[model samples]
Target: EKVAVVKEEVRSAAYKANVVKAERDALRLSLSVQETTQKKQVEQLQTLIEVAKAGNQDYSISNEESIKQTLNVSEQLNEQAHAEMQEMRAKIARLEANASSEIQNLEQKVKVVEAVLVGEVPAKRMRRRVKTKMKAAGV
Candidate 1:
């Protein structure tokens, strides 16, 4: 009878030890899963930070390029406008010169007509022709 009782007690102790060992293994596995998940999350956050920094740099570079292009276009427009203004001034000066020459020609014609009418030059034949035409026209 004592031998049989000893065998039963040893079996019970072994079973309880086995249960404790299983619980410890399950806790160790849970901790390992949590640690790995946290590591992955940290790495992902780090990658996002780097990407945001790169994007910010790209934005600044693009802005600089945009400003440069705008200035270049503005300068080109200004140069074209200046050239057009100079061309217009030249055209106006030519027109004024032509008008002055036309006025001088008209003034000379007026002077010749006055000299012909006033009988002050050596034009006796022109005076006799005008008198004959006036008499024929009944003026």
Candidate 2:
């Protein structure tokens, strides 16, 4: 009778341990699935960022006024897209201004380089020509 009781006690303990282990395994699997889902969401957000950057390309703008209007619509939508649109507009505006400034600087540098190549024309003469062109263009 003592031996039988001991065996039954051992079996009961083993069964309880197995049940507890199974629950732990299930919890681990649930946690893993949740992690995977969260990772996918993060990747999707990254893709949206890339798409927003693409929209900032200057060549893509057919008409600035029309685009500005559409931007106004997007701003009204309060969609996730609105944030991206606003960000792209601000970045593109800054980039365009910088690019225009750089282009002007490069043009001036090129004229200086040309003067250097063609032998000495006084700096004053080149400056006069550039100034005249700018005045003519109202810039």
Candidate 3:
């Protein structure tokens, strides 16, 4: 009976671990996809910029200022896109770290629960006390 219980607990731990790993992998894959898309967009922008520069040599006197203004707008857009990409990457890093921490805590709780069920001294209580604390604070 004891061996059966241990085996079940180990299986549960393995399942939870796999879930955590899968979640992390999914997030990483999403970041990779976003990065690839951003890279293509940047490359396209550079090609367009080069094309405009090439066309500038044939510009008329009256159209020169208009062309310059258009170039300025394109430059601004490129800068904004770059800035937004940086911001998004930063957010992804933070979210990945938070998810990793949560997964670790969950694994620890599972270990504690397994230990307690096997009549061992639990290293830490597995109960989620946060809900009680939140209710007390009227959250």
* Candidate that scores best on TM-score: 3
Decoy 3 TM-score against native: 0.48
How many residue-pair clashes does candidate 1 contain? Answer: 0
Candidate order by decreasing TM-score: 3, 1, 2
Worst 10 residues of 2 by lDDT: 1-10
Which is superior by lDDT, 1 or 3?
A: 3
How many clashing pairs does model 2 include?
0
TM-score per prediction, in order, is 0.46, 0.39, 0.48
Superior candidate under lDDT, 1 versus 2: 1
Which has the better TM-score: candidate 2, or candidate 3?
Answer: 3
* Winner by TM-score between candidate 3 and candidate 1: 3
lDDT of 2 by residue, 24-132 (tens): 5665566556556655655565555556557767534445445556555544444444455456556555655655554454454445444444655568887677557
When sorted by lDDT, best at the front, the candidate numbers are: 3, 1, 2
Single out the weakest 10-residue window by summed lDDT for candidate 1. Answer: 1-10
